[model samples]
Target: MARRKGNNRKKTFGARDDRNNGEWTEIKKDNEKWETYYKAQKFIPEKDWDFFKKTCQTQLPLTFRITGNRKHANEILDIFKTKHLPQLGNVEFEGEIIKPPVNLPWYPDNLAWQLDVSKTVIRKNEQFSKTQRFLVLETSAGNISRQEAVSMIPPLLLDVEPHHKVLDTCAAPGSKTAQLIESLHSTSDEPTGFVIANDADARRSHMLVHQLKRLNSPNLLVVNHDAQFFPRIQIENNGKKSFVLFDRILCDVPCSGDGTMRKNINVWKDWNTQGGLGLHTVQYNILTRGLKLLKKGGRLVYSTCSLNPVENEAVVAQALRQWGDKIKLVDCSDRLPGLIREKGVSDWLVYDRNMDLKTKENRGDIKESCFPPTKEEAENFHLDRCIRVYQHFQNTGGFFIAVFEKNGETQKDAVVDEPPKEEPNSAIVKKMKTDSGDVVVTKKEKLPRDANEEPFIFIPSVHPELEKCWKFYGVDDKFDKNNCLVRNATGDPTRVVYTVSKSLKNIIESNEDRMKFIYAGVKLFVAQRSDIECPWRVQSESIPIMKHHMNSARVVECTEDALKVLLTHAFPTFDDFKDESLVSKLKELKTGCIFVSIKRNDPLKEDLFLPVWNGSKCANLMVAKDDTHELLYRIFGIETTRNEQKKPQQQDEKKEEGKMTENKI
Candidate 1:
């Protein structure tokens, strides 16, 4: 191959194929940008020619175009032509030409989504036909292959059918988010459930959205906000509709990413002890914030790609100290048994003097602690609940996971939180007679499933070919059946029945217009009152009780049978409603239902987030004229404006500089 010159983009070239001997050479004209070659040769590969051609072109063109000038490009081409053409055949560059592998790793044994084309030219290969088909296969413990990870999801997810609200904090390039979505959809069908995926950085947020879009999951919502400030997004789970308190939250916080060192050599360069420590505060804040977002008895899983103590154990310890009994550490050894589990207590690295003393006494080893002895030793000790996934297990990169359970009554019977305050027209009257002959109002526990023990019928539409799969279960409807209970006309629109409790029956009849439920049966109905203005909410304390009790009872069709059983049960505490209302008010305040108007001046003005009152003097935060102040107030609702504050000395200097005559006048 010889180098040609001129305007590469404007050059008009045509291929000259050889019928007998395949070879290709550039066709050049004197006036054109490129040089011409005589008698180009065609290259042939040992493998199937069609497959080889497709493989070369599918993921190569983007990297090849605009590589460099004609000479440089030809030089690169000559290398590939001489090296690969003889065996692979002269692959055409006209339509989607695949670039030749350059100086890259040739590790064919390791299976990945990409091919080992070159050191820097990693690419997605199109050779495998089962690229998108999901399958399930069992492998040795902790030795699951990539193909297995990709295929084993559907069945397990169907079994896990996670219906509760889930949050993926630090989600970017959302691989796990996609998995979560798939699991949610495959699980028992439930209407009105949602997943919130959030990321802090603006650029990565776009990537998160992009990855999620490919999954086509209707349940996911992407949010762009700092995890530390997520509490500001008020969620209402009013009795009528529950606001989202995450049932499951994944805090995959940012860390030093030591596990990624093989791909990102940059991580190993200039890595320091302080680098991991620097992220400790942010990681801790994110986990704590996630804890707040959890409903009572909700589960949270915190993971990191770093192996350092400051970034892992230290952060978890900080959370445990602050939350204490409110959050309990959950062992996840069963989920990842193949990977070695560094006993959380044994492997936990304590940096502070107080904690190090305990670790040393317990382990009788000083050198192994991540925080060995240093001037900062006193600062790093108190952490206890962090686990490390080491490279010692299954040749995989380091990963740390900690599952926390938010249980017990506000940390106290450890009873649940109160329910929302009743609306003026709510049927939950101040007082009502219980079946036990007490005039105690407010339902305590959840009502029974239905009026009778008839199994609740659900019809789900299946693919025509899969119709046989539904016959055994007696599925009458398809997607048309209500997967979730709703309070609507007749209360059994979806054919699901509900059973009302003795105390609740009066409330239900009192506000029949506002009452709603999923009558899975006569004695049981998923009851909710819709008259409330806010979203439905559930208190943290009530979550455990709800999960435990709900898990035991099976759904029934008749409402009467459910009521018979529910009437015998005591209502939940009066506090559940009180807690619900308190949380509802908090949500209202957070969602900005009450608007705060601000003034703005320059159109380009940034940092206008302050919420201030109308006509009030703005906070003296900026330097501007009355017009600017008014504009600030109008634009941001900040209480203070530039007009209310004196100009700073730096502004005075700039003003003086502006006044100086350009020409010596």
Candidate 2:
């Protein structure tokens, strides 16, 4: 399991600390240069400077967002709000008062929440054990996310709809990318749009896949590519091809990350004025590229985890100047009503690495764009629309966000390629070209060397294997059969069959020769070995996507109490349920995998859908052990699964591998 991030927040990278005589030593959070630089810019009031620095030095609170498939997330939230929140009243931990987690008012539907408590206390204290178990179980089940409170803002503000094509410019360790996907599936189980999560690092692209795959979103595609030179994609429409422009784009570019000082100790030690100044050009490049990829009237949000004006406002100023009146900053002063944030500074002083003010006369290596905007330029651009979140405000990490919308067409679009391409040998790509522009392909860049994903080949929709499964499950014409896909060269359903969204299917089919698509699709079917009518079984992860497409008569309803019995035992007989109706339904059906919708008597009154392996006389819950434990504890106040799949060599030992990575939320 991923480590539970402490109350304050978590970072993916950290330096090893030194220990003296087994005692931990804390690093000094004081930085003279950091204080001097911010004081010069005066982003906050002078009276609040001391408080801001103090807040940065202190530890952050534990924050998390309830997430997952929409129906499942709502069910978890209902259990938390109605069952857990009211029990922990007037609790005190150590010298401080530990309050129940409260909802972030700016967040929609009370989905985001935070509380002041450390991770150690949560693990060891009896007062928090109930809530801790709930968090751990749901987080493991891919329902709850322990992300920072402020980290959830940009995706929410992007306001993704079910039909908008979205792009996450630098998505890795994909917390925000998951949020955008949940929004896409919010209105309907089958959404029309898709998300392209692009990260430059090949290994980090795999990280993106790991984080997002659990959501089972067929609309999301993770790719390894430089954000500065992201590939151009064209969709075949009306027997012709056109470049696919995004409806919403997010540019959460890399920055100095000084805004995360409260949670990251290294930020306080390594921060310098040059940190932001050096990153200004790249930040500007990414945001501009994102804008170019956006459709006219589309919205793009540019943001960073830094407070430096050079990194925040300076980057926004340059993009505004280059785009002219074609794009403008969105006025969000009234948005996020409960959020406490300051307006973007219209003007600021620029300093060099040596702490000398860089004026036009003595500006040595300082880029002209790094300097403050002229008086008239500021008025025309309305830089004040940008948001500046301070550390002291609401006791959260500092952040800066600027929303922009494209208003008109541009004269030209940039298409970056090298020279020419060699003949295609692999399924990666032959050459990247669209209707709007020609692609530049070099000899060495013929195929993606890092991606090892098998080719996505479509099988015959009316094949014998599919016909058996569809008929057995009562799958009708509501779901498209042509979208059935297999990841082999022969266009055959060998082991697992997949399904992708219509939008994603088009991209993969059109650009399979050149695009580096790492992973996409939900596991629609898996080859099964049982004496059942169907040769393939529906995957548990795909139940939410398939619930509406399958017949209601095929679904088996069970009481919540009976669900606990199946989760705790390995293979319980039908008579173990002690319910005549449930036993009759099990006897009447063919023995194979089937969907079991549990009828709950909780405040939410939502039916929980799960997959079960039904045999001639016995049945078992088809979920992982972590998942089984979650249902047991959440519903029946029981923890621990009675049946664990045994690994003979290490039967006594628990699961532990050295490959654990930290959460970077």
For candidate 1, write residues 1-665 as lDDT tens digits: 22232433442234333432546554321211000000010112234334422332221211111111233224323433453334322223325444332221111111122212332222232211111111001011101122212122111221224465677787776766665655565433232455667787756876776556533343565655677666323322334422245677888888877544433444434344445656778888788888877778777877787666556665676676666577777654455333344644323334332222335556443223233333343234322344554433323345666677787434321222332323443233234233334342332222232353122222112222123212321333432222222243222223222222222232333322221221211211111222222112221112211222321111111122222121221221112223444224333332111111122233333212211110111111111133233332323333332125322323333343331111100
Clashing residue pairs, backbone N/CA/C < 3 A, model 2: 7-61, 7-62, 8-60, 8-61, 428-513, 429-513, 429-514, 430-513
Worst 10 contiguous positions by lDDT, candidate 1: 32-41
Candidate 1 structure, TM-score to reference: 0.38
lDDT string for model 2 (137-200, tens) is: 7888888888887888889789999999999999988988998998998887788999999998
TM-score on alpha carbons, each prediction: 0.38, 0.87
Overall lDDT per candidate, in order of appearance = 0.38, 0.78
